[model samples]
Target: MEFNEIIERIVKSTNLSAEVLNSKINDKIAELDNLVSKEGAAHIIANELGVNLIDSDASQDFVNIKNLVGGLRNVIVLGKVTDTFPVTTFEKDGKKKQVGSLSLNDGTGFARVVFWDDSINIFKNIKENDIIKVINAYVKENKFGKLELHVSYRTKVRVNPDDIDPKSINATDKQSKAEFVDIVEIKPDSFVKCFGAIVQVYKKNIFFNVCPQCGKSIKSDEGLSMCSEHGKVSPSRKMFVTFVLDDGTGTIRCTSFGRDAEVIMGMPTIEAIKLADSHEDSTFPVDSIKSKILGKEVFIYGRTSLNTFTNSIEIITSRIVENIDYNVELKRIAEEVEFGDKN
Candidate 1:
């Protein structure tokens, strides 16, 4: 039998009562399986054992804070919901009212918990620094792709203002541990490293024909790129980069927009515009943008937004480091370029 199986069997045969030993043994088995799957099992065991499970492995679920929050379907976290502050909203019925969001945080991370209508009353009564336990909450993405956690009809939430210290609650710090070791906490605006490869580079002047109906680029009959679907409609000039990065949990998209694109890609605004213009009617080579960052692992620090619709992050405040410490791969690339020159 495997080591865990042996332990489970041995723990079972012990003179100790089955209730005490079985609960713990089963929980251990569940934990060994994977972190995300163990949550429910661990929570159940915690109830029976009267002990909190700390720092198991959120790596599986938290690929990136934004991506994880965006992709989460049904999840449980030990956190608190912020009391109502102030909110304003316009209703579909042509009515407008001030509303507030219940910000939920377990000290490790936070999510905006929206309360509407009658639910607003319950939230308004909550005081700041209150500790709340949340379960069965669903993750939704905002317009900007930031993940916001919501309390569904089936969500189970427990609120206790006096028993918990909003600040004292220890949370798992996945990123920002290396460089910011001196910092006791990860602030919202603090910078964190993101890893990914540059899959695309866009310049505002580069023109590519896209389908008017789907917004997908298509080859124009004129030999110049034009959205034949739109027939006479003008093509848009915008730069977009798609990159894949992993945070020891899972791989996610890292995007840069507008000015951020110029800074990260080292392309001046006017130059980028000119490049876009040259490619406007045809598929331009991604060389200028691609050569700067191709298969290399680049590090970026910026704001991450969770795309709820696509279940990914749209990294905005991003800047790239051309030369990183991962030298072994770069050296190989250097050799390859040298050989190509010789040919």
Candidate 2:
């Protein structure tokens, strides 16, 4: 339970004013040598007052995104869907399984909700901007140390529940807005936009194989392309580019995939593929296009994630904007200044 909710419960059960409850919570904090957070102190106070803050039935209460921790089971959460991804299929133990994911924001923070197997059917009905209530979910930390809410067949989902006030979800569309910031100010697990010049481009190992049907990476199996979901199939070539971007504040490594990679290369996938075929060198396409993108200025909007191997934050580009207009940029700056002055 959140601190404010706990305090509300204590006030109702023990007939204590909110101010008095806060005072006692503060005293508890000081008594513990300021080692405990206000919410922890509030929990202790609720315990001493014989007030049960946690609901006897866990599914009835919603847990705030900020309070989520790993290993939590039978958890309930309510949030606005910020993003959804395509469902992917895989084979495990001679059985096929599907997985899908979406991002949720509850005004406290954002979390990724993963659906497995039959649970993906629930995800198929979900869309961006919808308010959802998830019951009987479990929490686990991803390899990157980010908390994720996993939904299985036993979990229940309510889409835009009638009891929830849409107005109460302050972060309904907040995560969709990408704040433009300097590369130096970028943090992990955040959506951001930046304007920078491509300082360096890595030209080798630019192409990868993907299953044409589902667009997932495919592997070479005995001289045949094999997709875990599609079995043996012809694979299509996909492109990705990694480069260092500098905006005078700092430099960050940014990666662009597929169409965005083609944009950066100033060439289409077919043309690049033919170029590589002609030379019989898979690295030839990047070698041909590297000079054209060096020192090119562009705007990138994407999510930042920690690259654990590098111990640094990197951007996985969602969209890349090139050929910027100086006049439009000046007008935007003027409007921002005017709005700031009015506020």
Candidate 3:
């Protein structure tokens, strides 16, 4: 058990705020001339308060970010917030729902923490570089097969705990370089940058509805477009492109969203929308662009995930680097060769 967990247990038993308990623990530490550790002081305080700090079934402990896996429950973790995303709202079953997320790093690895509905209130108080302790949170694999920590009603989050030194928490940089890998080496839950040629394109269902205000997908409610954040409103169209990329070693399906899709199609989304309107065929935009895209070489930076229905891995492209740079490619190849030789 960690010192934070001990303090939490004492707080629960004594109905005391963590601040008050921390003050007592600090005084205890000072009274002993700094001879005892924070955990030792916490134990002494708990004993004086007549709080039972032991539990036979106490399995929850601080888990490192890298070791977290899907389907984990009652998890505890402490990490520094690296990035925070705005809260997004959507409608589900005619009710409004809000979700917010932040990226956390604990030096070992990085993970995303998702706050749902009421939990967004807690997320709102968090800021970048804040060291937060999360207790009773759950871990689940997202659609991309990446593990995410989800905060529920039972979860307790302490932001910048007094006993912890901010300097001691060294978080990994979120903008670290992505691994460069070939299509054959792509693995689920990994981000990679690869160079490939467009070999095939799926032209059907190239456009979808989105909320103009938030750019999130909007649903039809009783034949009316509804955005959870903005309520009923006019929706905008967003385009996505799906195609197969082959890098000579292997071929993998890839999907690019919005602006990235526009890059792949060689035209703006409005032009495609206009073309679709003129032809009265939604698939015509992609149909017209397919000939231009085939055999085009480009660099793809994206995340790989399993396509459950197809039982194969696919890439959700984050970026497409066009107009190939042969010099950089040669250097990357040389590095790969050197790495292989070292192995």
Candidate 4:
């Protein structure tokens, strides 16, 4: 039987229900099992169950900035004060008051908490690596288009030495892998993906024959063409080729040749060599490329690659697919850009 069915049978046999179960205890046991598993058992099980394993969503106990919403009840969180700002005191005559901001994280996510005068004394005692509990905190959007959580007068802060144990927090901790499409949509510091075809080839350098003395790239010594750099020598001609790939949104040039290039281009050994030999300094027109790309959609993702030899940029791609809706992609890109501007 499947895992879920087995779990259900066990629960039915025991006549146990969530109302009688201790969430913290169960979470701890699961976390322990996950930690001991060969490969992230907790996350794997959570994935199989379609559960949001990580506590990524905002909670009333801990108000994380990334998931903050205006006028929402904040979360209670326990984490070390990873970073702290200086406490600035405003003075009026003989009176003085303290104020500052601090950032905390427990590897899952982060939150910046601002402290006022009364709370400054409590926060001032907070040192790096000190685990503290925050209650009744909330998040608000800052001027720079980022969310920040602050502790108000009603909020309470306390240092819990027992909670210093990482294992205790691990039992409650959760994390999720980034979604491929969401990375692009959310603009949350992600890698770029694309796909397309080879269209043209160009021979940048070639050695026709060899020199009698110096073995280097030389021009043809025959009357057909006199060597300008060399006195009188024949050199081998070097060959390189360029290929253009078309995706619905755009056509990109991926210039490569030889065995590796032929494999990706799906060209025969002889055909690949012929294309490389034709140093036609001509490129397929943009209109023709657009027409080809309009029908096919390929998938690619990678950081930009630079060609040191040719002093050009070639984007690396993978997972080529065809017949994609370019308009949908365009709309997604537009929305992501617009949303990223808010952050």
Point out the higher-scoring one by TM-score: 1 or 4: 1
Q: How far does residue 277 in candidate 4 sit from its true spot (Å)?
A: 47
The Cα RMSD in angstroms, rounded to one decimal, for candidate 4 relative to the true structure is 21.0
- Model 4 worst lDDT run, 10 consecutive residues: 171-180
Each candidate: how many clashes? Answer: 11, 0, 0, 34
Point out where model 3 deviates above 4 Å: 1-176, 325-343
Q: Per-residue lDDT of 1-343 in model 4, one digit per residue for the tens?
A: 3444434433444554533323423564576764543224333444544544344432334534345564444356666665555566665356775556665665555666667657888888887556777776655543323344567665788776553564444322211111233111323133444434333433233112444455454554346433455576544332233445554344455433333333333334444335545744222222223343333423344334556786544644322222223344335335544654685
| lDDT tens digits by residue: candidate 1, 32-80 | 6745333355444444554433335332322323344554655765555
Candidate 4 ranges beyond 4 A from true positions:
1-65, 92-95, 167-343
CA lDDT of each candidate?
A: 0.49, 0.81, 0.81, 0.46
**Candidate 1 — worst ten consecutive residues by lDDT sum?**
178-187
TM-score for each prediction?
A: 0.34, 0.45, 0.45, 0.33
**How well is each residue in 40-146 modelled by candidate 2, as lDDT tens digits?**
99989989989987767553488898899877778889999976756767665678867677778888877778776678888999998899999988786533335
The positional error of residue 116 in candidate 4, measured at the CA in angstroms, is 0.9
- As a TM-score, model 2 comes out at 0.45
Ranking by TM-score: 3, 2, 1, 4
Query: Which 10 residues in a row give candidate 3 its minimum summed lDDT?
Result: 324-333
Which should have the higher TM-score, number 1 or number 2?
2
